[model samples]
Target: MHLLPSNLIIFPNWLQPEELLYLDLERVIKTIATHPDSNKIILFIDTTSIYEEDADLVVSSVLMNLLLLEDLDVTEEYEISLLGNADRIEWESIVSCIHARIILENENQELLTSFLVKNIPSYKVEDLSNIPLGQLVFNLSKKLFLEERWKEAITQYQKLLEMQSGDADIYWNLSHCYRHLNLLDEYFNTLQQGIKLYPTHERLHFSLIIDFRQNGRIQEAILSADHAAKCFPDDYTFQLLKYLTVPSIYDSQAEISFYRQRYTQGLQNLIQRTSLKTTEEQNSALAGIGRLTNFFLSYQAQNDIDLQRQYGNLVHEIMAVNYPQWCVPLSMSKLQPNNKIRIGYVSHYLHSYSGTLWLTGWLRHSNHESFQIYCYYTGNEPDPITKQFQEYSDAFHHIPDNLPAACEQIIVDKLHILVFPEIGMNPQTMQMAGLRLAPVQCVAWGHPVTTGLPTIDYFLSSELMEPKNAQEHYSEKLIRLPNIGVSYPKPYIPPVIKTRSDFQLPDDAVIYLCCQAPFKYLPQYDFIFAEIAHCVPQAKFLFLRGTLLQPRLKGAFAAIGLNSEDYCVFLSIPERLDYLMINLLSDVYLDTFTWSGGNTTLEAIACNLPIVTCPGEFMRGRHSDSFLKMLGVTDTIAENEAEYIEIAVKLGLDLAWRSTIAERMSQNHDRLFDDKACVVGLEAFYKQVCSKH
Candidate 1:
């Protein structure tokens, strides 16, 4: 059998089918028995797609077969070219077939050296700088990104950008690198440039909206969303982005007015646009009109259950149009007894934040034998509590921030049950929760409201936390657990204590601690604070400072005829101990109206502080009341706003009554802390729900 002796011979899968046919080869051999008269052999291997299993196997097999060609000339110059990423490949197998591993991507010899040491181990990689400029720079930049060398990646990508400015992916990635390096200006510039180059690019445009929102540039974010919608008028995702951009409520009073104005106008504009002749325009307008955040926030202010359900249906319809392709159901046979039921938990707060405090107990006591826990985290960074959550889970995935990627990963996991600790808090997670990625999906009361998503099967609530007909409040089946559906861990009191003097509080003054975030303080609730302050002459209302500045807070207080000087806004104390100490320093803990505190209330209880709470119609407004009830301290549980003010005044001024309440709290506080029984109820609930599904 005669074989061709070609100097530029490419592998079977490397070249195109046309190129293969043009070669007109007889029988392709892995190795050539080199003639004594053979000249220099330049072997080029296209390992670009070697990350694929088949390609890796083929390349490995071909290289191994080179040893079979014993008569092949060894003296002639043999050059090997590696086309793509070699860091992940088993380079030793291929390296043995060639003299040196030639990296066709990067010019940085040090990068090649480090990669060789870490990946191939003890083998050296040569940076072949003579390769094509665009391919070399693109690979080098990508390699830098994979290695998490952010600054280097930015430089390399920027260099590549000059050569191929039209590449949207490059711009997207380079902007990400700039973000990781905390170069906000560069990040903005890169996205702007990318959008200018590729105006219709959804990914880059979507990123601009996300970047602006994450950085607290709400107006810019809304504008970016508007730009995206205008650029891609028929794109459902951009339309969704526009709808999500301006939240009805905001963290600060300045933003509250700004957002309310924006959303109110935005909604009205959308409604007017809904009358447009184009069905596409009408659909977008209708979806915006029925957006969950705006509707839910509006219902919260007015307690309109009908409006809530109406908006929920609207959102469901919009989601069906936006994400029409539902995930295929997992096989029942996959749920084998010995295999253990795969229960996945998705949350952006798997870290040390107050949101994850109650969840830690369930994770800590998870039955590893009966259930396998998978945690998909979306928070910015993991903390000590995050480590604990990871320790208890069978698998811990730091979910990528991208919506589609996160949702795709959850779908690919084939979870028997997927739970979102809170869906409405994070827009990215909210987007994922709209997809049917599991056999069963549930949302806990971390957000303390219904998700309004059709994909969500259950609202995992606590029996103690909800009203008699709580099912009517939720779109999903309300699965009420025996207690507040989590076992609370005992609050950690750091040994170092803070005093009133440390916070510059007067010893004789009655301190009323309303420690809820600013947004939780509805303008309607400002009257209660003012009334309490007026009733107790020496009262000082201490609130945890949110994104709102003193001026905004002062304006809120001034609206109700209260002097700003009568209250103190405490900046967030990074030390948990300091926070607990501050709670201890207060005479009365006044829970916020409508959206009451959960972890904050528990912390006050643990510190034996008297909390005055006026329960509202919804479960969100009743958490503090529930905890107070659990502890058997209903003296501070008010029936109305007047009673709420009266209780707060009594606690603030009447030292004897306040002391008695504090004593009762001291005795009963243990009842609410670390109830492991709640964990058992939760596990049973999970089992029941999974079994039913």
Candidate 2:
């Protein structure tokens, strides 16, 4: 007889129904009842189980993993006797060490971790020698993974793999550790291994699709999504994921239109067909949906507030179905003058990413006495930026990846305002954004798009970025702050001096630096490159190397009768200093049309480069324009495409005008950085929101 585990028991070796299949849980319950204060287990087994497979099941220590599934309150321990033939197994091979636990949730995990350490007083974090190897290592590994201590967990999991080579979970979790460490190659490789080794592992396959989309390999992601949907016919997650797959960079405008149409049709079909019959099915489907985002939808340069609201409503409905209590709007308590209002911020990008560059300033410059700052960082990596977030906040929580556990943690905090730095960029953030965790829920401009979720009460934006009609762009009530909407800290310039030769730039050529990622370059703007290359013989557009979308740009150049090889320069820079060097050396900074630069523009301006921008209809396109307006440098701000090309050309051709613009940028750029007024406005906004609601 083999009990599979918690809640479910399986007797696999029932060769004769009358004997082996006659076992029931009544006798086991009776045994546990009698020894209520002690650990007790009862198993009905005999020599009728003669097969070697049956003996292996009874003998293996891994099967004992079930004891950890439930909350066992007993103070004493129990023993098991393995019945096996002498030739099949030796008596000494039995593992008779103390029983181990598997961590199910954060509370139980802490208890188990403390228990393990108490057992062997001197046991180190990595040491698993004193206890039974498999159970302790697995326990420690899960603990470390949940706590975002990935490297140590990787060590323990790798040890588990050496013992059980065929373990699918080990491969899945190792891949998870690699992902948290930002080891993309290892992450991809391990996912591939898991997919090939255990083709039926649903999470491994879907996770690969997400990885592909994240790394800008959208085509591969689409293929993997299609394959995974076919493989798991019953699971609606894969089916929904197929529709959620949006490309970061489009080869053409028509390609964008095609995908937009496909997504709408696919989403409609998904809505019509999705009818989850059981609680498990509904939970799984919603979890998968929660991990998806409409981040790429904003890049299309169209108004999607209605579409977003529709999708948001669907997500809200699903969330309400899965978590009724969490979806309900929380009641607020009016704060006393002496008491600091508890404010919480949640995001995965509180680490060394573009998100921290803009948002951390708000944290750094906030009035700590009047308002308490609590950060729920969903990301795994611990960087210098993350350390700063911890230092600046009142309570910094490195939240686990599990949605319910993380949500419960935030609920327990009893925050006055729960803020998501951005909603659409991260899946878990999106999941939380759809729920009313606090009395006042607000989303900032980290991703710079409105979350259509009804749960969000406010959208924080910049006065300079949003147009007069920008109120119509969001589902939430818009709250615009002064001067670029961010208390942006000035970027530190490395003191190293370098010549143009260090980067292999042509001495005679006029370098136009387009520092935005390849996705930011719309297909219609490809003609701008060919036009500039045709006009100025010495024009060379500089871009960072190692992206798949570069070839599409090259092809666009080729179609317009220009060999991008001669006119474009793609160089691999070593570090941020080198990127800043490119900004310093470039003749003109060319901002993308529809999706204008944010952090890159700020960095380039800080380096004293003249930014030429043509703001689009949406706020996303006006970031650089806002920065320029804030700096009192308006000469390079173009009103149209012709003006954009003309301004860019003049900046490239006229050295004196370029220098004049650079000098003006250098003089007035101080006003744009570390603006305490922006923080003051934000704090006031928070106070106003609290009082009104």
Candidate 3:
């Protein structure tokens, strides 16, 4: 009956070992009564590992006894510490017996307030702010939402709805939680509920429309945007959302052309709409376009310079009107040779598994004395890579999601140069790229697409990745950095070894791994898989599971007289260790034809997997090809789609040839990784840009 130094405790379970169930309860109660002299009593239910039906009944019985004890000693503090999901507990059934509710992992006061408010007769919670229970819960939910604890935040928001208290903002936050958690069905349902209850809530309506577009429901997305535009004629954002909307996955290349034309027309319409608009009106519309980048357009494998320039100017006009002081080009005095150049990097991807994977080399090996490094991050998550950035930074600012505040802070730093490592991927970065925050503003190939912003002075790209005359493809002055344009660290090979069977893949099959996302696999290139299957009997293509786009590829196979179910394997995307193994086990790495792989291809190379890629028009479409060229292995580089399919089929049939190429890659990987020459070229380029400025 003695309480030990360890806080671990056991509970009764009637379902298992029923003969001792009675004795179990008796001993548990005896221990509690003996331990009660400390004036604190706790019933800890750690269901994270195991849960039984009798847990609630035992907790109830124990609580009932404890409450009776509390009557004898009213000052004894009683609590229930929940180590697992709080939802499984029947709180309503046992609320009367509880003095406090504790969620161990999530130590927040909201649960206590929730407990006190629900059990109104027995307990009371007071606050200096005098906020109501609903407001208190709302505030905590918002805090959790900002911290990206989606599930916990969802639980807090759901409490408001359960208590017959809800609002548009609550629903909006709930919808976002579900969205991040990939509960699309629940996400849509929450948005619908919010929209129906608060029909005129502009943001709620906007969220619904944006959700539709992002989910690949093109018709519904466009229709909702159009409807909202009509409802709020003054809100040009809704109209712009409709105008800029493109398909998440194209049915065919023809669809791409169709959307491209629509996009061009949309730009024209947007131009006229902003021509005479007031500054306030234009600024209000910035959110519509600024809230999203034209992300999907790069997948089409076409030159975006003209359209991008048009859109860039369109955005610039609005920014210029709204913030004329900031929009004006920055004035600068010529820097003396010995003065440390003040350089700034503004991005949302300064973390691992992001575009920073390439930018890290610059941050890691920069000339700290010559360059005063300033990293302004728009993301909150701080992983190992982010820590490296912080360690190297002269000043590190993890800016919240506030565009104006971020801009003002950067301007106050009076940076001589600003670099956006990646643009046209994140909306906030995209919008910020449209403004002239520094005297010499530049962007690198984070997204591998030209930003087209006139405010941008240069486009830093990889000489290896750029096609001949690549400047025609970009709106900014192009500066091609040497080699891969990154002093990329060699990929860390995990020691965990796995086989094909671990992923439920056939051990005997010739697996061609194409691990790109669903939208990246345009239907136009889906036939390439079927054609490879036509020649190689043992060919089995592996893809990441995306239910929505599976049918599109399946239908493409069907058109080619092949049943996709037989030749195609879709497994849920694996953890990082398994992803590396997928590349290692596969006979050939089939690169997505138009938009070539970046990090995945780098990983595949680390595994010595032979990559078959066809270079396309733009830099984004040429990552793997350039990587192969750097490795001195160009046998797998295809000139066209025909050559791409031929090379892929050859790699499948000729194992010896594939092995030779893989061997060559392994030997020359040194040429690809940890090449400090890129930093040298970049520093020289930086000096050149600054001198010109």
Candidate 4:
């Protein structure tokens, strides 16, 4: 076999059929024997030959042989080159192969570190005018991206886009390159162009939604998601996108319920379709189901355990199983004998939100001597809560940049137990958890669902949050905490109730209040409330206004006939603690379905305000149910629209019963306000995880 010169061995335009086959076979065997470093081997198949059946086979054979040589060490000095007639080959097949090879070769050190560095800069746009050369550029660019040479990757993607103008995939790749480079404007513009060009392309629209979200264009993201859902009602991605987008505009509970219903429908449809399909179709359906199942489990959302177990079994049957990725980085058995158990809590919600507010009590009281608390703060905002968390933890690391790297570093530090306080809600936090940052990873109460990712080991739950029978819905093992719920103290002082007269309301009216975010109020909720108002003619609905009372949001509410004084009252309170004052003025608290209240509900209960809650079908929707149960206020739990209205009316009419409940609730506030209990439970959970590790 004659070795071709590295520079002159460009793709040939034409060759005899037998000659090409022979050359391909020779290259395959040589590649096998030499095990040429991926960096040194530049296989250039003339996509022109890809259309010919035998030539296509030859090219595929060459690729297979090269892939087989992956684990073998071949001579590093000589490079392997394959020249194909691009005009004869099937362009799509050739492009797909090129993409696969680029991804695969990225794992080869010699190729990733040296060959990419050496050849990427040398290959210029002008040099790739020919079709085969252009394909080569695309492959190299993909390799650059895989290697994290983002700047060079952008340049390469740009060159390809310029050459293959209006190519949706190329444009999509360019958008990704721009995104990876943090060029937000260009990333979104490029994706929008791609969406315009390929309106039916679900992936492009999905990318647009994600980009819009990452760029902080929440409204645009929702709009894009809505458009996507309308366009592809049956597409799983569209359903997921709709589910994800709702939290930005509506209440978290409502968003969770809506998505969970969609997910269930999607999953059931997938399973039914799989049963009726051919083998190939079944395989595809299984893969789709796997993705959905994983998604549900990844975020600790409501899932069907039997469905997930079936999906997991199918996945295992189809794809070869390997040890979980987290186990690859560290020797778990070796680290068990260590004296100090390093416990790491991974969260993006360590700021002044519900997650931080709820978990801070626990973090503050974690046992520092037995369990070393490592706070991995993944959020961008470093609020007062984050500062408090840092001060409380034994070690605190802020990971606002390079999340995967930070996670990997944490894993390297050999933390015994890693806890994810929130997942699926925050991208960076999920990404970090996906990297497997600890030996024993547990998902706690950041969001009210399971993290479907395989990296997470346990779902930290109470009997109320996840019943043992429902364990199958989650991907992780159920690690139950003691008691009905996790508790947090009211750290800030409750603001004194301001008179309705002070806030410009009628002095004699019975106030019905909803302190939850306005976005959580669905159209159905508006109808329910309207019905409630029709029943209780004396009651004036009051809403605690903050960001939700923005002009546009208020206008939206007004359109639903909830305008100021007519059906609603928006009280703009400057401080969050003032919410207590607002609650005190109201005769009753109306909790929204789908998205129930968290901190606000707790505060309302603490203020002895009767909270009327409608429990939805999913875990997120049932939060208020659990809270009410824990507070021994099951009478406040409404099962449906009719029941909710009935409960409100009953509470409004029976002032004596309301007074008795209020007095009891004010006395029972101590049970829910046990800051000490939260601290103890959290410390125990941490200790247990460390001991197991």
Model 3 error, position 311 (Å): 1.0
lDDT of 4 by residue, 1-693 (tens): 232212112232334455655454444335434432233234443333344565557655554655575543333444444434433234333332232232221122332343322343333222322325356566767776777766756766776666566367777777887887768788889889888888887678878876565444667887898898788755644544554342333334455566556545655554443331345544443233323323323232334455444443433332222113443444453434546677777776778888657777666666666667788776678877888888888888887655446656686667777777766555456545554456677777656665556666787766554443656557788766655346576645455656767678776677888777554555445556666766677777777643343444345446656543465666767666566667777788888776577777777787788888877655566666777776777887887889988989877778898888788787776666654654566567766655565
Per-prediction RMSD in angstroms?
A: 14.6, 14.4, 9.3, 18.8
lDDT of 1 by residue, 536-560 (tens): 8888877765544355556766877
Q: Arrange candidates by lDDT, highest first: which order?
A: 3, 2, 1, 4
lDDT of 2: 0.74
Model 2 residue 408 lDDT score: 87
Q: Give Cα distance to truth, residue 278, candidate 3, Å.
A: 4.3
lDDT winner: 3
| C-alpha lDDT of residue 210 in model 2 | 78
The residue ranges of model 1 lying beyond 4 angstroms of the native Cα positions read: 1-299, 302-326, 329-339, 402-413, 546-562, 568-572
Number of the top candidate by TM-score? 3
Candidate 3 regions exceeding 4 Å error are 1-166, 169-183, 275-279
Structural similarity to truth (TM-score) of each candidate: 0.62, 0.72, 0.78, 0.55
Worst 10 residues of 2 by lDDT: 3-12
Runs in model 4 deviating more than 4 A are: 1-329, 333-338, 518-527, 544-565, 570-574, 614-617, 639-642, 675-693
Q: Clashing pairs in model 2?
A: none
